[model samples]
Target: MGRWRPPAEKKSKYITATGYKRMNDELKYLWKVKRPEVTQAVKEAAAQGDRSENAEYIYGKKQLREIDRRVRYLSKRLDDITVVDRIPDDQGTVFFGAWVTIADEEDNEQRYRIVGPDEIEASGQLISVDSPLARQLLKKQVGDEVYLQKPDGSEIWYEVIAIEYEPY
Candidate 1:
């Protein structure tokens, strides 16, 4: 198997206190409650029959393995991760946690919020701050043009329309 981890990326300094608590709570639940439950399930399934042909036993083992895998991942990840709670000083540009609106050359408008990797949601266009598009947008202000390299041998350009971090 390939190596399980890469060098940790710097996290954004933009998550709210509530967001931090949510992450911590999830980690605690996985370690204390879910891990033990899955372990007990695996033990019970293993006791039921021969290991070679038992479907329940096989699936139970897989479940245990996945749980253990996540537990190890969370332990390592949480240690290296620094929760980003302080909002950025610059509010006029597209900074971490800022909701930005952009208009393409074709006049199609899009909205995105630059967020930390762990908290990003594709559905909301909540992109990670480390993403190429976000990187290109870092310090640009209204009406400034930003271009992003795409995998399809072409680039896309967007004109910054607005940036905001206040109450929506």
Candidate 2:
């Protein structure tokens, strides 16, 4: 088999104000603080005799490449994204940046914030707007039910119990 792979699907460009700020902050830190520090380390390492066997020089160069890659990606993403700073007029409906609380038939509830793909967190509280759950929840008002079919062929339903624009 070849090492070739298909291109990834394009991600949505809508980002909340907080998420945009976070991305910008990361870009700035990587470009301003981190890059200069690594450059200096690499320079010092290069000055010390032979570079072929110099572990510090090789490691520093690798770190520089990774940092530059991230910086470039963040810069382009920031320029392309649209920042959603204001809350929507319809507070009762699920929309971007809204904190939605959903409940299953058993009354088990979970809260999630609809954010851009870049802002999806490991905490599970933030979900990308392009996600299946968020797509079904969009424009849905409180008391509305959302149906989703899992990849495993199981079906589940969730009722929108509450929707808030502000973070809790």
Candidate 3:
């Protein structure tokens, strides 16, 4: 069976100043260090001959392809990104770059930074602003109830505990 998925995530042109800097740094590191290192490895592997049977060659080539793909994606993303350098005037509503705390029906507290899809990372509870949950949370204020209609004919309920634009 195929896995379920939301539509392709679309990111806003505006990113927080810190987010922009992190993306820029990643792109720079990939191009200046990782890209060249992978290219060199691929070349070295190729020089050994018999690439069809060469595991190193195959892996190097695959890694290089993946790196190049990301490099290109970051290039386009950076160009499109606006880099929201200043905070917005809205304080009561949840929007892009907002830090939100919510409690589910189970009384489990969750904190997440709503950010562009390109900025998501596992280290932090970062939710893509374009996600279904984020979409429901957007424009909502503290004390507002949000109900997410899931695919399994069930709904998840959450109440906004706090919504602040400050970056964490």
Candidate 4:
């Protein structure tokens, strides 16, 4: 099979203000602090001569390439994203940046905050707006039922218990 793959589908451009700031801070740190430190190390390694066998020099160059790639991606993404700083007028309804509490039929309760794709963290509390669950939760209010179809073909239902804009 050919190595070529189709391009990924574009993600939503909406981002919470905190998420945007976090990305901006990362870009600045990589460009100003991390990049300079790595560059200095590479320069020192090169001065030692015989770069072909120099592990430090080769590693530093690879690090620089990775940093540059990340910087480029962050710069372009920041320019394209829209920061959502204001709370929606309808606080009772689910929307971007809203923390929603949901309960299953068995009375198991779970909470999640709907955020932009860039802000989806390893923490399970945050869900991307592009996610199937978030899509179903959008515009839903308390006492509303949401149905989500899992990849395994099992469907589950959840009831909206609460929705809040402020972070706990």
Best by lDDT: 4
lDDT of 1 by residue, 27-146 (tens): 799889987887788788778878888887788778778877877876776666666555667778776667789999899999988777777764967888878888898888998999
Give a tens-digit lDDT track for model 2, residues 1-168.
899989989999999988988999999999999999999999999999799999999999999999999999999999999998888877988889999999998999999999999999899999999999999999999999999999999999999999999742
Q: What is the TM-score (0 to 1) of candidate 1? A: 0.80
Candidate 2: regions farther than 4 A off: 1-3
**Model 3 scores what on Cα lDDT?**
0.86
lDDT of the candidates, in the order given: 0.78, 0.94, 0.86, 0.96
Clashing residue pairs for model 2: none
Clash-forming residue pairs, model 3: none
RMSD of 4: 1.7
Model 1: which ten-residue window has the lowest total lDDT? 11-20
Using alpha carbons, what is the TM-score of model 4?
A: 0.96
- Whose TM-score is higher: candidate 3's or candidate 4's? 4
Overlapping backbone residue pairs in candidate 3 total 0
lDDT per residue for candidate 3 within 1-168, as digits (tens), equals: 899888974656767788888888998999999989988998998999999999999998898889889989989989988776656688888877888999999899999988877778887689887788888998999999999998998999999999877743
Residue pairs whose backbone atoms clash in candidate 4? none
